[model samples]
Structures are given as structure tokens and as C-alpha cells.
Target: MAILSETPELPKAAVSPQALVGAASPLWAYFGGAAATGLAWWWMTRFTPQNLEAMFETAAVAPLKAVEVAEDAVVEEIAAPLQAAAELVPAVTSGTIEAAETVEPVMGGEAAPLGPVAAELIREEEAVQAAATPVRPRRTPPVPPSSDT
Candidate 1:
């Protein structure tokens, strides 16, 4: 009676792989796995830019590009005035002589060589242009700020 009451053993159930597989649906396992992957992707995309050094590098380059574009525009503006002035000198001097020749026949119809005054003015204009020519050498781009910690 003691053995029957205290030591009776029940037969253990055996589990086979196929029986275990049939018990649980594969679809639920796949859905849970997919959900976990999606959550991970969302988290990484949300925080990836701050964590990556390349984003800061790209930001740093933007100012340098702006500076380069501004420099080009400044140089162009400065050159335009100088070019106009240079053209005016030739046109004014030559156009006057040509007009004189056509309207009132000049002596022997030989155009006078440019006078010393004209030569001096041309020289002065050229000197001014030489001085105005932008002497700035192409500058190397500034180094990006260090992100190294």
C-alpha cells in the first residue's frame, strides 16, 4: 500500500520532430520573425544619420561650395567693368577719326597714328587692368572639422 501510494510511476509521453512541428504553425513563427526585423530596420534608419560620420562631412562641404561660387561671381563682376572700359577707349578714339574722315575729307585721307596722349591713356588703362586682375591663387578647400572623439 505504501509503494502504490508513494511510488507509482506514469508512462512518459514521447515527442517526435514531425509531431512537434505539426503542433505549432510555421506561419506564426515567420510573422513574428518579420515583425522583429521591421522594428530593427525602423530603429536603425531613425538614428543612423547622427551615428554616421559621413553626414557631418557632407554638411561641412556645403559652406566651402558656397564660398567658391561667391568668389566666382565676384571675379566676374570685377572683370565686366574693366572690359567695358577697355572697349570704350578703342571705340571712342577710332570712331571719332572714322567719322571725321567720312564727313569732312581729311588731308590726304591718311588716318593719323594714335597720338602720345592716346598712347599714354591706353597704357594707363592697361596698367589699371593689370592691377585689377584678380591675383588670388586658387585656394585649397578648407579641411573638414574633425569628428574624431
Candidate 2:
């Protein structure tokens, strides 16, 4: 058998533009529909009511929690000083009593003997009276006597 050197050329089929468009239209529609569906799904997940509510709740709660913590710290700071003052109350009371016992009252040019209890009661009463009473305004200074009277 003799081998032919030339290769046979295949017939080129003529394709119409309408047929090409018709064939690709379904694929374009499918891809476009898939893209639209994917976009809708992303939008729904990103802006869901639950997601929005949680984001707002976190924003609201963070400041409230910080305020609560600051309030607790302020209360603790105030209480520490008050607690220290309370502990000193007994010592101060005993010292006042000791001073009262040693001090003698001068009444009508005579040394009057007064008890510590009586002194403490008088001091408390005076304090209460002073607190209850309102302060008086200052009096105007007296004018000089006129030269021609």
C-alpha cells in the first residue's frame, strides 16, 4: 500500500449568531440567577433582624457595664474613708470623756464641779440647738453724733 503525504481537510461548519446566542442564553441565565441568589443570601445573612438586634444590644450594654463598674469603684472609695472614720470614733469618745473629767467649770467666781456625763449632755444639746437655729445678720455700725445738735 502507498502512503499519501497530504492530510485531508475537515469541512468547517457554518454557525449562525442567533444559534450561538440561543445556546449561550441558558448558561448566562443560569449563572445570572445563581449570582442573584448568592447576593440575596449574603444580604439576608448580613442584615438579619437578629444580627442587628445583637449589634445594638452589645453597643448599649458596653457603656452600661462600664458605668456600673465606675459606680462600684466610687462607692468603694467613699466607703473606705467612712470605715476608717468609724473605727476612730471610740478612741475620740474616750479622749473627750477623759478631758471632760479633768476640766473644772468656773461659775460665779467659784470652781464648779461638773460630771463628764453632764458635760457631754450639755455639749450635745448645744450642738443640736446651734444646728437648729438660723444665723442672724450683722448689725449696722453706729453713726457719729452730729456736731450741731
Candidate 3:
């Protein structure tokens, strides 16, 4: 087999004037996009703040507060059920059930009453631990190989 020529002939695609105009313009397209984005941002800030704030205040605060409230409500609701279940266990084991059973509430209703000194000591220990331990830096130190242990 023999090679046809040093230079290879390339096939040409048929392009129109509209295509040529479209082709001349990657820069223009990028600039137009940037300009349009700026304009949109300006427009949104100017025209949309009142409506946005009304939505935003409720939108931001409500969900977070709602989530917290929901979590608290769930905990509150589950506690009574759990306490009742715990009380029932004793009844199941022994056939004789007391009419006036004193079931301890499960909600941990009382705030943890840690002494000020104890709380301070715990905080100090945590601070010491935080200070003592430094995270290892990204770059590893080069290790020299040993000939013998």
C-alpha cells in the first residue's frame, strides 16, 4: 500500500450566514449572560425585597422554630407513652396489679441540676483537652529508613 499525499484533504461543512453570525460570538454570548445576570440581580433586589422579606422572615424562622417545636413535642408525647409502657411491664410479669401505682415520669422534666463547681470543672477539662490536642497538619514529615531496628 502507498500513501496518497503528504497533506490530507478535509471535508467542508455547509454553513449559513445565521450560522456564521452565531459562530463569531462566544465572547458576546458570555458578556450578554453576565450583563443579564447583573440586571436580574439588580431587579430582584429593588423590586422584590418587600415581598421577599415577608416570605423570608416566616420562611427562615418558622421552619427552624417549627422543627425545634416538633422535636420537643415528639419528645413530650413519647414520654407519657414510654412511662405507661414501663408501668405495664410490671403488671405483665405479676398477675396482681396495684391500683395506685407510682410511675416515675420519663420526660426528664427537671433540668439537669449540676453544681456550679462541677460544671466549671467539666468545662475546664474540656478546654484542657481542646488545647492539648492539635490536629496533624496536611503535609507528612519525611521518614528516614532504618537499616536495623
Tens digits of per-residue lDDT, candidate 1, 24-91, equal: 75567888899999999998888733545787888899999999999999999899899888888854
Off by over 4 Å in 2: 1-50, 90-149
TM-scores for every candidate against the unseen true structure: 0.23, 0.25, 0.26
CA error at residue 27 for candidate 2, angstroms = 48
Tens-place lDDT digits, model 2, residues 1-149? 23455667768777655666764555788888999999999998897355788889999999999999999999999998999899888755887989999999856877678899999999999999999999999999999999998
Question: What C-alpha lDDT does candidate 2 achieve relative to the native structure?
Answer: 0.85
Shift of residue 13 alpha carbon in model 1, Å: 75
Cα deviation of 48 in candidate 2 (Å)?
9.0
At residue 20, candidate 1 shows an lDDT of: 53
Number of clashing pairs per prediction, in order: 0, 0, 0
Query: Candidate 1, overall lDDT?
Result: 0.84
Q: In candidate 3, which residue pairs clash?
A: none
Which one is best on lDDT?
2
40-131, model 3: which lDDT tens digit per residue?
A: 99988887335777777887887898899899999999999999988888534343344235555577568888999999999999999999
